[model samples]
Target chain A: MKKTINIPLGSQHIALLEPVRFSFTCENETIVGVEADVGYVHRGVELACTTTFKFKQVGYVVARVCGLCAIIHSTCYTLAAEELMGQEVPRRASYLRLIANELDRIHSHMLCLAHTAENAGFEALFMRTMKDRELVMEAQEAMTGNRVQFDYVSIGGVNRDITTDIEALIRQRLGLLKEKVGEIKELFENNWSLSLKYKGVGIITAENAYRNSALGPLARASGIDFDVRNESAYLPYGELGFASVTMSEGDIHARNMVRLLEVFESIRLIESALDGLPEGEIAAKVRGTPEGESYMRVEAPRGECFYYLKASKGQYLDRVRIKTPTFGSVPAMIEALKGANYADAPAIIASFDPCLSCTAR
Target chain B: MFKALLNALKNLFSAPATLNYPFVSSPKHQGARGLILFDEPKCVWCLKCEEVCPPGAIRFTQDRESYAYTYHYNPYLCIYCAECVRACPDKAQALSQCSELSRPTSDPFMNDAWFALEKEAEDSKEAVKELKKAKKTEETPQP
Candidate 1:
């Protein structure tokens, strides 16, 4: 029998930090079709950047577009400006940027995992995870002098230098974090109820994930094995040897595992970066005319973030366009949610770790 | 299923792995970026901090009579980059430790107040001597 069921999951739910609406058509308890409606918190960042803000000032504006991935936004935007000016950033500055970026990934992924635990009614685990997550924030604060929105990256290169003390502090913290993460992972792995709830839920086929162009852990969990860190090899990532994690199941459990495993990889990258960091100036003096358009991409917490920028002789930017990972993953999310139980909708949504602020920006 | 339940129950007897946050504070490292502070008495009117601030959160105006600088820091736009602290040549010592800055509905331009510049003890003495000398010279009469 063909019947229509409207399950409007809205602009405000426990599962989401930002506002987004999803309408699902379900046959009995299983969802048959899904529709997404975003733009609840659109501040028109691109428009604002082009209209009133200058090139140097746009970094601050772009950083506010998404608080979780603020550093990535600023880094990518600054790199775009650098490319337009045909400038080469100092090697030390690039490493510092990489350190900040990796720390951000750790914090962001920990938050996502904590949220998942919260949604699953594991309050104890949630609180513990958040507390442990603060270590990364502290590391970031030590390095860039701010927990969020470091403003460490500038057009020419990074704005600050990492001292020997700061490098040693990062190394010590990573050592402690390794032990903490192992404990947390053991706790999660031992919980049978968590396993049952997350495993085999919201399954996305490898073929569909590829066809819809999903990126980051979402694609990798479905055995895609694609990462901008490997393909694009930006910043100091090329020197660091790390493997992209993947699982064939493509379920909620697999995605969670991929994120969990990637956390360690990020830690290793940070450690390796600190060990072999080159000595150089933190920033270069940039002066010239930017006449053409250029594109830059970075692997953000959610997925791949692509930035398109156009500059003229004037100080004000001519055009600024950003393609966030949320936009790319929304379609795949809808596809994954189809045929899942209605109760599983929130779990499926949270699995992608959607960042609506990035999307609306 | 019964065996799975038994195993799950066995896991409950293990020690809880979560941190007790309200009762316990998170670990702090030496270089943690806690907060920003301003020293009212040590400022010069250079406005270098204002020039180097990426977010334009710091503002200062000159007091011509005193030849001193007045500074303001708006926490709303302050990304806490500490560039201002580094750029101050006088070591104005304006920046201090602070942690609880983020607030609800922060206004970027709200920070506007005057901080008095600190005068060195020797400079104060020199000023007094100069004033007395000027008075004596005036009393002595000029040709």
Candidate 2:
């Protein structure tokens, strides 16, 4: 008889939102060894960026890599390209970029929370969270002019200006969202049944998180106290008074708590960003092609999204290297799954908020 | 569980949250990025929109004999990023974006026709370049 049985969860599974495969070698009911394949959704975006699109157009090309974090990808790429060109972005443009990025974070965190609830077999909570998410979606559409793919970031600055009417819409919607999120946070923190599915399950210790290089909410849950936004000047997060949320338990529940608290922080940041939005032209004139190599990293909803651009003053870039958060979180994911119960697999995976479209691209 | 029961009961009597999709249309907000609109007379034939469009949704085919240009747009191929509108020169103001989204086409050959047009657009540009070179040579004295 075989000592252990291998069970696969993904590449096509009911629990997954994107295509990623995980093979678990289980000893009885516990997963003993784990392997993950995050390349199932690869679309050859890097090759297309270098060979097909011009430097000015590559911002739009990379935005299609991950739908949930589209703005982050474009913002990171635009920042890097601008660095190569020595472009000066207006103060107002950076604030608008920050606002859009935080809105992206808030909605994405809500989505992961909803999925986690659904995975835990709490279907009603999933629906409720999804319902609350629409408020932010409407606000985002009003601000950036699209529901999902916000092509708001451009080479020098942003594409759209913040009118007073749009500002009022965002404030009203975010205000409603803040109230609703408070209720949801209470439910996540106090609901007895939810604690069963999330508490002390699939824990990643602080040292383990450091060793495996887990990032974003995953690492923050493990008390890592590391966030790309606080660590980098890619955006104006520091000036926006950004503060990262963290927890010590390092379990599914802790991750959820971190994400929920981060939502509050993100909403506050957006409100402040709006209030301090300087008066200036939305877009500065883009005059030249990017030359030489430049690197940039931005805090996407998942984690740090890094972009490497090497241009030789040409229309098309020589290379565009993207390193997404899910790719970095894989080792930590495998580490967490080692001793977890097989039944907790889906819930644990959802808590990571893995965006395989980003990783594989 | 009792709290859940009360909430469920109260929610059952409340009006539904979702809109009636078939009867009530959900319109995007004002200035929502959508379809690109082009004006023929206002265009200076600068070909700037064609150059900046990422997905090559906008193309211009030049007449080889008359040196005139015709603008071609495929809404199906467009990503609605509005880069063309921004790229259009300020004086021309020939390009703008409206909030109406692209509708799905019933034509089976829509994509095929677009692909053919893309190839023709490239070939026509090449032909125009060759014609311009010939004209320049005819005017210059032979070495």
Writing each residue's lDDT as its tens digit, candidate 2 over A1-361 gives: 8999999998999988879999999999999999999888879999999999998899999999999999999999999999999899999999999999999999999999999999999998898899999999999999988899998999999998989999999999999999999988988888899999999999999999999999899999999999988888877888878888999999999999999999999999999999888898888988888889889988888888999999898899999999999999999999998999999999999999999999999
Model 1, runs deviating above 4 Å:
B1-55, B59-76, B83-143
- State the DockQ of every prediction: 0.24, 0.74
Candidate number of the best TM-score:
2
For model 1 chain A, give the 10-residue run with minimal summed lDDT: A182-191
Candidate lDDT scores, in order, read: 0.80, 0.92
Model 1 residue B90 lDDT? 52
Q: What is the TM-score of chain A alone in each candidate?
A: 0.97, 0.99
Write model 2 residue lDDT over B1-143, tens digit each, in one string.
56666767888899887989989998669988877878989999889999999999998988989989999888877888999998889999999987776563444337888889889999999999999999999999999
